[model samples]
Target: MPVIDQLRDSLGWDVVLTDDADRDARSHDTWPVATVWAKLGRHPHRPDAVVRASSVEDVVTTLRIAAQTGTPVTAWGLGSSVTGQPLPVAGGIVLDLAGLVSEPVLDEIDRTVTVAAGVRGSDLESWLGERGLTLNHSPQSLGRSTVGGWIATRATGQFSSRYGGIEDLVVGYQVVLADGTVADLGQRPRAAMGPDLKQLFLGSEGTLGVVTRVTCKVFAHPEHRVVEAFTLPDVEAGLTAMRQISQCGLRPFLVRFYDRDEAAHAVPHEEISAPVLFLGHEGLTSVATAEHAAATAIVASLGGTSMGAAPVDAWLSRRYDFSTVENLLAEPGGYAETVEVANVWSRLAPMYAELKQTLAPLATEVLGHFSHVYDQGSSLYMILLGRADDDETALARLEEIWARAMKVVVAHDGEISHHHGGGLARQPWVRESLGTGYPVLQKLKDGLDPAGLLNPGKLGFGRR
Candidate 1:
């Protein structure tokens, strides 16, 4: 019997899907290229079967069956991945984690919560809101992304300047390896005995193991919240203002600066505007007020005009859905693509100028937006758009633009990726980024999964 058939017979029939339509539907992730590729009958790639696993036993059974038959296994979350990280290349079982949703257990004493992998961020946030707690990790895909998917991709949210990424929030994790062995890491608050294994799976992108559950540190809901928007004369002034705020130790929960073009595209102010900066503050009522005052003083010193609460509130309300390409493509003769890069504070200004100069000639329209703030520096998410005769031509143009921009980023000592995981598209550059450490990771993969049966052709792994 085939692997899918045997698994269906072993587990319930409802848990396994082998229908052509079903397999095709679950194959690709939310890659923007899929919007064009699907119409051309060239879907990204599809797995042999889709397995909806409900419990840890279900995962163990699926992994064991795949291991016994030497079949590849790829885990799927809510299918919100933009990097094609969940694509099943070897035609085996696509283990959907959506069925593992379970009510979270809150340990108030420890200020942490243990949640099932399939839990959606919006769902968890609402559940925690009733109990006066919050995860403080709200990525742009919060409405659709699952907890496991976020951790698997090592996602950073808008509030990362204050709460940090999923890596920082993770206290412990339950993961099932390719060999059907379960490994639990860091149940205690802190450990100093050995290397941190939990960090390994936090951003493995399903190459290492399947995360079934996660224990994450949570914070009490802030008593007060304040948002401020400022219009700056130029991008450099905005960057300088943000750097000064960080240096002064204000630590605003959210701080983002958009270039003039991006500001026009997003906010579109007629009365008074140049580049724009959005800052959010949240904490105890008194503390939040103090931070807001500090931020106001800093913006004023940098020659920025404070637009007050209305624009900031509107921007916050619609921030998550604004950048989605689907929404942009809906407009007449409109299409959009985004690329992100990270650099140290000292290099960011020059890098930004160089990136703009490099892509401006090639792209019909280009804009840069600063998001995902950190203590050290910030990330730049660049948007590009153009007119094309067809989808393929449009994608080719975008790739050319990305290539030129990446060259400038590398020259400026910046990372090629900040929040987005390196999927098949970015695999070519993985060796360049990891250098000698790349081979060490490959050896680790060989030792754990010699057959290369776990999500082949990803993160620069498997036989060429």
Candidate 2:
């Protein structure tokens, strides 16, 4: 019998799936053509077998088996990723991280917590809330995406403008390597070591190892929060307002800009004559009040029209419900897709315009929104919808749209991906993004995963 067959007998039929139907279902993450029409040009590859690992031992055993058989290994989280990062191209074992749901341990004295890889963001937040603490990370996919996957992808949450991304929150990690070696990065409050090795697996996307547990910094639950919304004359005006607010040094937890179409899609036939910007502040009562005052003053100075708090509250309520994308995709003659691009403060306006102009013709409807603000600039999330004969055609159209948009971004000097890692979808642009140092990245991949057993064909380094 094959190794997988023997392993199936040892691990039980319920844990190991070899059926074609089961394999097909487990092989691919949710990469329907409608969801990627504005991002890539091809259908995602599905893995050969998906091993639903229930414990660290299972993960170690699975990796050991793959190493012995020269099979590739990829980790799967919640399948919420737009990039084909979790897709299995080499037809090997997928170490599904969903099965490892261990509860987090909060150390009130240290003001820190240890979380399992499988804990979803929203669940973790609620769990911590019961103990007078909270995980501030609130990505759009918070309800479904796992902590391990978030750290693996270096996800930026809605509050990244204030709280920072997963990279900032992560302090330590427990990882399982390709050869089944367990490595524990220090769990101390601070380390004076030569290098922070935890960062290696933080954004590794399973190329280096599997993250089983994580220790992240947490904050006390805010005593007060204020939400505000405004309308700017145009995308450029919105950008200006955002830049002014950032320069003012009042960091709002949520700062979002929706272009004309995105504003319409998000707010519906509301009489907004301009782009919409939403701001949220959270902290102690006094801090929240001060932040709100500062934010409102900046918006007023920039000719923004205040729309009260309803819109901001609505966004907060439904921030994690991306299931709507799937519903939109299921519509007849309807499709849904999103592409995110980041550029310098100066290039944001032009990049936004160029992206809209490039994708407008190909899409029946094109909407753009900006979030994940930084000191330098912000990232644009472009949502596109259209009609297509099949997933392949839709994906092809997306590839064309991204090609044009990427060209404009590169010409104007911007990074290809901000929060989203380069799965197989963005491999073509990796060289351009890395420039002269691209070879160094390949060398690192070669050194760490000599057998190329980890997430092969993704991140633009490994052999296909």
Q: TM-score of every model?
A: 0.94, 0.93
Alpha-carbon shift of residue 151 in model 1 (angstroms): 1.2
Query: Candidate 1: what lDDT?
Result: 0.81
Q: Distance from true position, residue 346, model 1, in Å?
A: 2.0
Q: Which stretches of candidate 2 lie over 4 Å from their true place?
A: 9-13, 34-44, 389-392
Candidate 1 C-alpha error for residue 115, in Å: 1.7
| Decoy 1 TM-score against native | 0.94
All candidates: CA RMSD (Å): 2.1, 2.8
Q: Write the per-residue lDDT of candidate 2 for residues 342-413, one digit (tens) a residue.
A: 987988888888888888888888888888887789998888878777656665776777677778778878
Clashes of 2: 1
Candidate 1 local lDDT, 1-464, one digit each (tens): 48878898889899998888878877766765554455456756788889999998899899989888988888899888776788887778899999899999999999998889999989998988899998999898898899988878889898988888899888988998888899888747667878888788777788878899988888998889999888998888898888888878888888889898878766754453589898989999999999989888999988999887777787777878745477655443345667888887899999989888888775577889887776578899887776666666766665676578767877787877898887765666777777778888888788777778778878888632
